[model samples]
Target: MYHKKMKSKVVRITCIGLSILTLAFVSILIYSFYGSKKTIQPDALLHQYMANINDGKYEEMYTLLSEQSQAIVSQEDFILKNQKIYEGIEGKNLTIKITKIDELGKTQILVSYDTYMDTLAGDISFSNEAYFTKNDNKEYRLLWQPQLIFPMLNPDDKVRVNTLKAERGDILDRNGEVIVGKGIASSIGLVPGKMSDSKELDIARVSELLDIPVDHINKALNATYVKDDTFVPLKKIPKDQQELEEALLEVPGIKISDIAVRVYPFGEKTSHLTGYIQNINAEELKKLKEQNYNANSIIGKSGLEKIFEDRIRAIDGYEIIVVDSSGEKKETLAKMSPKDGETLKLTIDAQIQSVLYDQFREDKSCSVAINPKTGEVLALVSTPTFDSNDFVLGMSTDKWNVLNADTNKPLFNRFKVALCPGSCFKPIIGAIGLTTEVIKPSDNYESSGLSWQKDGSWGEYKVTTLKEYGDQVNLQNALVYSDNIYFAKAALNIGGDLLAEQLTNIGFQETIPFELGMYPSSFSNTGTFDTEIQLADSGYGQAQILINPLHMASIYSAFVNDGNMIKPYLIYKESTVPEYWKEQVFTKEAAQIVRNDLIQVIENGTGSDAKIDSLTLAGKTGTAEIKQSKDDHEGTELGWFSLFTVDEHTENPILVITMVEDVKERGGSHYVIQKVKTVFEKR
Candidate 1:
């Protein structure tokens, strides 16, 4: 009986143990199942969302979302946002492949699709990848924002937030006053796609309202809107009159958008330095697209604008609007706030620039002022200038043609393009003679009003003499009298190649690399000659050698700053990129010697016309020959003058270079000198 009881107990205990083991296994399985169900898988959501999108069931794809997601987004927004994608994939077979599944439960879907547009034809195709996430409810939805796919398209929903459109950074003078400002303008815009019936649109009404000819409006409308479905501007109407209001009311198809027009209050006075901005054209748009730039944006056309474009252009903000199948906005989904560009503080002094402009207006000439000590350009003035405001508002074709046709070439920046350095080249020769030891302070050559060739082939070239020095004149007197013979002798001693090399080192033969584009002036060697004729001509600033007025001014600056070769700069500071401002170039001694000699020229030589009372001035004058093919006055010379003045305290010297083309009508050097004197007198 005892043995039977023990066996029963053992059997019962074994049964209990097996039962416990089975229960533990079942519990583990239940826990695992629930845990997996609770976890949200973004990849699953992405797959489902992509599948729905491919099927054109935007509402179904949008509904599979968490409460937070649903509250933030709407069905109409989803449809509108995906409309562009659908359009892009229209008429082409699309293959959606899941490329990457990450630990965040997000899946990247690669969409291979083709598109057709007026600009792009022949079934253009490209592959784009997007990411999506799965919610806890086991629903998959797109995780990537719509902007990633259709960057140019509007968002589906409007974000309800007070957001400011950041303004582009101000262009300020050294004093921190705004050179370019925002103002309200009468803007005429047209929705090429929106205008259904061209007959219903009153071209006459638009012309009357905008104060333009009816024919002009009709032509623009036909050219821009007749064949394309896009927004095109007929013109930016000037708000100087009240007709804009009357036009907006009468023109049903015309829309007036508040546009921020850039204004230069100082007008033409700052035109050369500040440059101008204009609407992007088709060519510009194509280039911008290649550069990954916004199609509808303004860009710098010249001067500082071109130099600091990256720093001054603001990051454009975006609005998300949901659109429908027909490409109509339903609602806004999200928005990105724009950031303003950094302000640029230019080294330009408006006051000085104004003074220089007025000074050059007396004659059809241009001048450039550079800070010899630092290579900073103070003022660049090109006279006979047009209002830069014309460029800001998009100049009329008539005005552009007139400016282009003007004999003075008012559109040309004379300081950068026109070259006539004449006697101004003498200083460079002097420097070369001094540096090469070809002519010492003690060395003297006879200036009998002429220097003759050793071969006696060419008759002696006449040189003006202040005094008869018995066939011997020192460097001081040679410079003072502007003696061609003395310089010729010096040039022969130094050799033409060496002279060219020296002149090049002091800023000649190449374009002055300022913030503006410059034309490279010519420099040629006096064909390997045994005589000093070519050298003498080059020494007196003539012959095949040429240089721009701005370059001449910079070379003079090198003289004033004591031999420091500094690269001319216009921009002082940019908030966006600080690295550009850190560049330093120039030496002080080299600039000073040149400066001292220039001062002596103003005080005692040909540049005496430039002297101002109480100011220690230095200058040189040149009458450069212009070949006949250049203009009507082929034989007439261009007057050139460059000078720098030491203020009363002698702390900072101001350098200026002026070039007057075809100045023979006004007495060449004599006339130019008087103009320089007038400027100094005003100072």
Candidate 2:
């Protein structure tokens, strides 16, 4: 019985021991399961907050931390400081994922997370291992060891984004060929905050690599600052080789990014028409914001680009990434693809444009060639033009200064800016005289080289002429010879008020409303002129009359092609109708009489120089006096000749107009007519 009792006691003790062991195992299993189930622990949450802070998601990341953390860092302080850090991360994809959690004593936790980061500028992709420490209650958190962290958050990450870039739009010839588009150009970027620790960044070494001066690298490194534990750069990295290399020495921190540059292959050839784009400065930004534009972009400084900026700017896209304490990306939560700008096709013929550019290279001249029937501009040329490409990739400060200070004003689009109609105004006046019945087509007048006053006091109204031909000269002979007296007589008969009214009816004295602004040529209204001299001078295409080459071209188009004044247009078609205009302005018959007379001028008058062998052309020439100062008899003549071809075989007419300003030696209009002859012969 005693042995049996002792054995029973031993068995009970063994059972108790087994139960204790099983209970301990079960408790451990439960703890392990809870720990492995991804529970939101204080330390885990603190790590996430630190990651958020590093990634620049301060508010949400802050929320994840315990109340103690919030007390330690106020929302305002956190925002202000993290904004600097966040700026560094802008345009970068950063994400983090928790990989492990380790308890450190009773009050601290070490959390490890995996990170992935990408920078679009350098096409760089990086993966890193990171860790952060959190208090037991997840209240306060900090980077466990910043130096040991492979992917330390850079302070300059923010300032790098703020650096100015010259964003450019594509350049297309009138035919829609890509003359200039987005091109990749190598650039260097510096993270000021990243390089704040100058010891880690060897300026000389970097300068050697990038071919920049050591001083430059040192300057940039010194410019870095920390705000809310985030580093911000002070300046952009130098594009110089030494500077770029020195910046790269910091590797993942002092980054080198690529910039999109504007390119114009045609160079100076299409400069005037296409214009140029430039980076937006602070002042420009203010204006852009007022105009509802994106502040972080470039805008057309002049030419067609400025006129059509809305159609060419690319819509910005964004990506949402989750980052970790080590400033590495964990995942991409969402992405919005960028929308490319619309491609614009122009009506400008590159070949014709090149030809026209060459023609005016030696002189201060402007020309406008358009399809009279459609008002499609074929070639618009202005001399002393600059390469639109110079405006791209940030023109050197020296180059910019020279261009801006040039006396000739190469930047000005002389075709639209300088008004000098000269003899070109005659055809329009003739058309007015014919249409308004101010003078009959068969009306006759006599000229003795000059029109005189009844007193013959030297006629105070001597107009330079080619000498009188006969006693009775009709409109045909007068037009052929550009007889100043004949037109003067006609002007007297028609009256200045009536002439001005008629000219305005045909689209003069008003802004030539095209896609671009046209400089209005000066004009005046005079009724039945009592002064014979005023009437004669007006007849000879002088006396306060001025018009743009483009305007002159459009008006002349009306004269030749059945008199229907087609509104001059730039864009052939648009997806949507433009919002700022309406109505057409001139009659077909009115244009025909003018066209016939103009054709006769080309056939036999001063414009005879423009005659072509194969194409029957009609045109007129004018050399008007340019008034400089009172008592200073310095006469600078403006020459003009406009014509349209009468294709005998095709029965299709093509219009061309050429204007040359301030011709000192040969008659300006006469000189231009010779040029027209060359153009026609070539065509």
Per-residue CA lDDT of candidate 2, range 1-683, in tens?
A: 99999999999999999999999999999978765555466445545654665556767855654455467667776567556534543434555666667776765566656655443222223434433344454343543222212344333222223222333456576667776676655555554445455544445555555445666656655654533334323223223446445546455445555555666667677788778787777887876664434555667878787888888765555554545656567555334455566667776767777777777777677888876666777778888778876567545555677888987777767788646465566666666776776666677766656544424754343555565768667776777777766676677777766766666665555777788787876564432344556555666677656677777777666654555564667765543222222122334555665667767787777787777666778877777677763244776777777777755354434577777767758766777776766665665
TM-score quality measure for candidate 1: 0.67
Q: What lDDT does model 2 reach?
A: 0.62
Question: Quick one: best lDDT, which candidate?
Answer: 1
* Prediction-by-prediction clash tally: 42, 35
Ten-residue region with minimum lDDT total, candidate 1: 576-585
Per-residue alpha-carbon lDDT of candidate 1 for residues 153-243, written as tens digits (9 for 90 to 100): 3344222222335566778887777777666666786655555465445666665555556677667767733655545566664466466
lDDT of each: 0.63, 0.62
- The alpha-carbon root-mean-square deviation between model 1 and the true structure, to one decimal in Å, is 14.0
